[model samples]
Target: MDYIIKNEKLKLIYEPGKGAWTYHLRIPNSEHIEGKWGEIKVSGSIDDYKLESRNLALTKEGDKILSINNEIRTAINKKGGEGSNFNAYSQCSINCNFSLSVAIL
Candidate 1:
């Protein structure tokens, strides 16, 4: 089964195996991911990218993205509840990322 999580532009696709989960995150890139030959298409809006550029966390462009991503990961792990296998996914991560990346202008 697929556990899909997303907010606005970014999205994550999670596939759970017997003991592990495979993750596919759709992130904005300078070059858009195109669809052809069955390859997964990656795309983003410039406005969104610009907005992300304004995030206080990402202002300097160091490890903030990594930090943010980790925070999101942690949040996602916590979202599935305490006893329900905890194998679900959450789009809250995306919102967190977006909020951390919103533009001032």
Candidate 2:
């Protein structure tokens, strides 16, 4: 699993659990607005993410028809910490399909 950002490779570590998979992503040399930056830690479960299905709507007017676009619901999170105190940087939904494609990155 290769996670790439701006052509730079990212390091991802995976810890398998009985019900879920935990991921630790390490972004090297993350920069801040003030130029002071450090390592960024993100952790989450495989089930905590999801890809929603899109819906379409149509309307008819005599002999005409219309269509509506649907949006995808995505849940992305960035977490940090060491051991039991691991904290999530953002709100993450605990329901998603797990993929190991990005685990080896």
Best by lDDT: 1
Show the colliding residue pairs in model 2: 12-105, 42-79, 47-96, 49-96
Winning model by TM-score:
2
Error of model 2, residue 1, in angstroms = 25
| Span of ten consecutive residues with least summed lDDT in model 2 | 64-73
Question: Measured by TM-score, how close is model 1 to the native structure?
Answer: 0.21
Which tens-of-lDDT digit does each residue in 1-100 have in candidate 2? Answer: 2222233333333445511224433333222201111212223322245323211111122111111111111233333222221112211133221111
What's the CA error at residue 80 for candidate 1, in Å? 10
The deviation in Å at residue 24 for candidate 1 is 3.6
Q: What is the lDDT of residue 43 in candidate 2?
A: 37
Candidate 2 residues lying further than 4 Å off, grouped into runs, are 1-5, 15-21, 31-104
lDDT of each prediction vs. the true structure? 0.25, 0.24
In candidate 2 the C-alpha lDDT for residue 71 amounts to: 18
> Could you tell me the lDDT of residue 22 within candidate 2?
40
